[model samples]
Target: MGGSGDLDAQLRAAMFAHLARVSAAHPDGVPSDVINSFRFADAPMRLIVQPGIRKPAQLDAALTIRTTWTPPGAAAPYADEVGPDGSLRYKWRGTDPNHPDNRALREAMRRQAPLAYFYPVARGVYQAIYPVYLVDEDQSAHEFGVDLGQYPNDEDDSAETPLDRRYTRRLTLQRLHQVLFRPKVLRAYESRCALCRLRHAPLLDAAHILPDHHPHGEPVVPNGLAMCKIHHAAYDADIIGIRPDRVVEVRQDILTEIDGPMLRHGLQEMHGAKMFLPRSGRDHPDPERLEERYVQFRAA
Candidate 1:
């Protein structure tokens, strides 16, 4: 049996609608039953769509999903597998590569081979866009929470910037970490080790001014140093410490009997060298915090 001119368009629409409904209802995403039932793919290709989610939301219905098999031809034929009857069960198979069972479907998909990786539906959560919204939503300034300004919702008051949202999110997540020291510890150091300027953020750490087991009070930026692992242990154990004026100091105890170039070239020469400074005014490490950290540093 055959229909003319619009069978393909009609099938695509039905499939899309099914996916949307599944996404809207489940919140978690479409169930495999729903996905498989649609038979949505070129016989040789598998195709499915899912909504982008950051924080899981409680949804009351199963998500809608659409699947289709294409037939081989000059115009790849598209078959709509999902019906609006709400039967969330079904099965399908693409024609075998050599068997010709799926040949019609494979040819159809070849004609429509290049499909966009993902599409945006203004009303639905999209992947890249969802993360930005998760940020603005958590930030107090934008309690109402919205998208990244690409689309307008009936309720949104204004636009959004992706960079601003990302910054706010990163700042908040940092504040919530167990780093204990004033977040200024990180900000002061510009995410670089003060000694080597290892600028990668994740690789840099805010070393405690006082040892963790020490009955120390809360963390302060001055009480911390942005140090890479090697430098941090050395500084903590009194192998090294920087003077207020920026000169590095090696302990008199460590000057005993070391013949290695690393000891001579790295430490002795490094003495009196300036510590790296933060780029911005606010990032200046607190001298008071430094004094506190020095207590344990000097003892070793």
Candidate 2:
């Protein structure tokens, strides 16, 4: 048993390292092809197991959990939701708590073993969040409480004040929204900068047209624009702006500024150029939201 546990720890560490590299290369999500190719110690070990839970034959605890992606405008199949205490609620496989998969998860919770969570961002792709701990299991509710490395495994939830719990929940939701927002927006734009048309995925970001704190701001593809780092910074700082007509505008001062080639070509030369919008009309930016944000840039 001791040797088995040790091997499990080693295998988990290798899997974490492998996922880290894959995520760094593909910030959006891991494609099905890449996920299917994963191996450890020169042996066959599937990272993402089918049917959600993965319990390796050599290990007593579950090693990973997965959630399937639901198509846009479609109803979700699972009732998975965020708990009031800031934990993620993952539903059980079936009604039986004693089933192999459920028992593996319960054992993982008892052992306080860390597991990787494969969350789908799009069809046939997943964003990996690792070192997730199963803190609690409610058989009657047919769900398990999951912590996404935010709190220590042994932390007492009951000790938290109501205010603290609310704050934590808000933060958790915000993080989740941001995570899910980026890939969708980037995919809509084909992983290219809307302003400069840069095709580098790592250099691109999903810039929100209206700030997230704004009442009308929502984390949808229509409310976002994919941009390179410099352009994103310029957009946020009002150094450049996009009009409702999808034309780029450099701030008057920046347009006339005397600087190195970067400022000249990157910002000034981009003035009057039209943005590269998504191919799908439904994915286009909202004109009203753009006008509202343009007002801020004009004032600045």
Candidate 3:
């Protein structure tokens, strides 16, 4: 605890130093937590620094770059783009190894262990991205995709074919969606299950109203519901339905069947109950989206 606390202090100090320099150059003072976009050649990058270690060999001096964004109202060209190894593709034109600016930036990253900060992509929206660090200003395509080393491929496809690559890509993208989507849904629902009102974090999942592969489905919070693992599974299987009006409806067969406490208490009893929604109207599940998914549940 003591060591971590000290590390936190050192990180904050380094973050402030970066902010101070940025603020001096900008007419509008930059917030300590926000990296000024104009200050960086690409985008404001935050580095995670660890300064408490006594040995020089133990130091991680590189600033970790995690996310990138297009200006507001612009399309995200980098959407669904992650390397096979799970590294993010952040476009930065300043990677030419000979550039003095790149050299100075690298030096700064090595000295200040800046901390990871949330990047606001749009109004009332934020996300965390895969981590990366600057290597050199080589202007090579490899610089955009840093080798974070090979992670154990979760999808075991024995044959390294295009089909396998596609499967890996799909799995990797879904994993990224969960990272950014779950937290947003959990917060919107205040950590309570939308249907069952379950409050246990370990037992909860950020359930997607529409399967991710659906053309209209997005990683946005409005398309998600905080549901207990069981309810989420039931939802995905079309055993339970959420009406556009936020009513919970169980499949007719399940409701009429004689079952154990798990079915009766866990699901059947919730039929006709109102789903808990986000406090903000804008954050509520889109009625059209609900209707779209509900049609499937009703058919099942």
Better of 1 and 2 by TM-score: 2
Q: What's the lDDT for residue 91 in model 3? A: 39
lDDT of candidate 2 over 45-119, digit per residue (tens)? 887776789998988999999887889788877767887566578989888989999999999999889998888
* RMSD in Å for model 2: 2.3
Q: How many backbone clashes does candidate 2 have?
A: 0
Q: What is the lDDT of residue 95 in candidate 1?
A: 27
lDDT of 3 by residue, 133-192 (tens): 322222464233232223333354345786765655565556555556776677678778
Better of 1 and 2 by lDDT: 2
Candidate 3 has its poorest 10 consecutive residues by lDDT at 49-58
Off by over 4 Å in 2: 83-87, 153-158, 216-218
- List CA RMSD, all candidates: 20.4, 2.3, 11.0
How high is each candidate's TM-score? 0.39, 0.90, 0.55
- Among these predicted structures, which one has the highest lDDT? 2
Instruction: Candidate 3: list runs displaced more than 4 Å.
Output: 1-178
Candidate 1 lDDT over residue span 10-83, tens digit each: 44444555555654443222334443344433332123333211011111111122222222233422322222
